[model samples]
Target: MPEKTIPILPCRTLQPVLDFYTALGFEVTYQQRSPNPYAVVERGGIELQFFAMKQYEPAVSISTCYVLTDDVDGLYQAFRAGLKETYGRIPTRGLPRVGPLKDMTYGVRQFLVTDPGGNCVRVGQRTGGERHHGPAPQETFARALHFASLLADSKGDPAGAAKVVDRALALTDETPTRVQLLQLLVLRADAAARLGDEEAAVTGLARAAALHLTAAERDQGRDALTRLADLRGSLRP
Candidate 1:
């Protein structure tokens, strides 16, 4: 009367897959290399298994899974600390990277994590509040932020996300809110850095840092501020 499904993804090799999850505080439960290379990792209530495939390429991998966490922010911090300690930095691009937490237009607070095998583990926690039903934000920049976040973070297309943010900046006639401007600039910085445009990233981060915010705005944008700091850290040697 019950069902539990564990994803079995393909990896170019088992050690990398194991090491990546291990760095994220996952414990190795089962592993084998003699007959067929396979390994399983577990953290809290989540579990993932991997099998080796010699011809597999992580760049083109399309495998993914969804994981719901009750303590999304706390879990994120743990993963962040572990990854930084293990790899010396929290990777923001390419395979085996962790994404910043975001509140989506669809009423979810989530982040994307790609393992060494390119299997994206989308981890999220439903935010507090009653669901509000209404048409999407009509303003250009607000709309662009939604679309750009999906493209850049969810779909892993930094170049496309950068284009969306640029178009919004050029076309928006209405002035954006302080938080809106901050989010847009931070997202721009992320897209730029991932695309290997360090100058643009620096400019965006500086602009975001320069914006004035009241107590309310600062409290409201606490998460974005945290993400902004992460982006800035990424540029450091």
Candidate 2:
């Protein structure tokens, strides 16, 4: 027989916590509210237990667990689609979102998804003998945006995401194309809002809104605007 370990996490509310994981394809196996508040959820053989803590603050708490998967990419894609379908948009600035996959130096491909309670579920798979050829500058910037999305949306660390996007923007060429600039500004606005910096968020959004978009850039701009609106709406009042 094999031994299995399940993570016990704390959440401000048990029902919403259960709902979040359920939306991520987990099944609620057990739930109780009268006996000090507890619940259990399972998906693909992974089980997690959560307890309710009335004073738990997701922004300040540091709790995480790892879920090793045999198909990291597939699982990420499924979660991404599920999130988009449920939320109208993949929340990249306040709520849970699937992160970009990366081949870690530790010899595994991995990504992450944080529950609404700020419990990080690191999903990883062994990448035996696989080498990562560094990406080009544009590709690097794209990866940075993906990482920022994960930090802001999944980990509830918009401040951290802002730092990553800032470096990405700095490394960008001085005379970047309109599309490139638009993307960077949009991401900046998202991170700012998540960090509760309304002025910065407005400034970034204004800059992005003023950009002159080409026909192709118009399509991307529309999507970015929707994301920006969602991010702004989620900001603490």
Candidate 3:
């Protein structure tokens, strides 16, 4: 015996849904206008179906699907490329956006994608990690990143992530190293930018820039440094 499952989510309309999924390289497997408005899209083995509700609002829709895959990075890259090619830039920080890939404290590395219909697609791969119930009371750089990533990447709540990072920086007793500080500040800046808080973003990036690091430290934090640069580029007027 064999079985398969597909999510049928609600959308305000089907045209934008079709356009968005097609842009992400999902082929239109089926569509219908009779009986009711419906469409189906497929990418590899994954299939998603959408039903139209004329009065439905995608902004408030909480419909979602979980995609478990071994190649999280590859899928993210493909989606990112497709979105950028179609829109001339990848949309982030809002509906119809693809979030940056992140590894959470839990046993998963994932990316959050919000479709045009505001349905969420959480793509993740399992990794060895201690699954915890809630956020820890105490603050540390690592704990901060974990919590922030959970909000910003997993839940698409950059505002919450920004608050978490700010609280950690102001309250941490972990004595973070320069590289760690740089990483935290970069994330803070990113979250702020996503929230349309340009001043906070500038302040965070400037603070990160002011931190001194040895060559080895720079090498150790190349990823954060690169993101810092990208944030600067995005912040330009």
Candidate 4:
């Protein structure tokens, strides 16, 4: 017989935890309500066990897990679609939002998704060296976007951010998803504006505006519109 270890995680309530996993394509294998709550969820060959704790505070909890997979981007897309389907819109900054896929310094391409119970499940694919070749082109672009974000927001280097995005843009062509193209353009515009390059900012905004957007994309661009307006105001003579 082989020994398999399944994590037993604590949750404030079992139902939300169940719902979260269910949305991510997991099925409830067993559940109990009376005499202390507990449940088991399984997806593919992975299994998770969750227990209810009335005093559990997810905000202070330090529960985390790593889900290694060969198709990290595909699973991430599925999870993103599931989250949006369940929550109407994916959360931008909180538990339940999926983080962008990144190539860690430790040499793995990974993304993080925090469950309702505040459990961080990192989906990763081993890369770098003969053990694995490299991530797909889309994954590389995703990693670049993540780096550009840190440069723009954390390091406060908009020029560096613009350069990172420019490198990604060079790698991409018309085959890239409209969402990716739009996001890259928006980020570039933001970086240009922060660099005091009004012409470049205006040009990037115009390019983004020319793209045919879906209803959801239009709604998502509202924030971009506000930023564009502010940039235009600053450029007025």
Models sorted by lDDT, best on top:
1, 3, 2, 4
lDDT of 1 by residue, 1-237 (tens): 578889999989999889889899999999999799988899988999999989999989999998888888888898888888988887877678888888876666888889889899999887755344235677777788888988997678899999988887776467778998898889999999888898999899999999999999998888778778877777877
Best by lDDT: 1
In the range 1-237, model 2's lDDT, one tens digit per residue, is 798888999888887778778777889999988869999998878999999888999766578988888998688767766776676655554445444455554467776677788777889898776545333236666667667655764556778888987887787454456766676687778767656687998888778878878888877555465555555444435
Instruction: Put down candidate 3 lDDT per residue, 1-237, tens digits, no spaces.
Output: 589888999898898889888889999989999799999999997899999988988888888999989898788878877876887666765568776566666677777788878899999888865655445536477777777877776676888998888887897456778887888898888898888888999999999989989999998777577567656755666
Evaluated against the true structure, the overall lDDT of model 4 is 0.71
In order, candidate lDDTs are 0.86, 0.72, 0.81, 0.71
Between candidates 1 and 4, name the one with more favorable lDDT. 1
lDDT of 1: 0.86
Q: In candidate 4, how many Å is residue 127 off?
A: 1.2
lDDT of 3 at 130: 60
Clashes of each: 0, 0, 0, 0
CA lDDT, candidate 4, residue 165: 88
Write down the TM-score of every candidate. 0.91, 0.63, 0.81, 0.57
Model 2, CA-based lDDT: 0.72
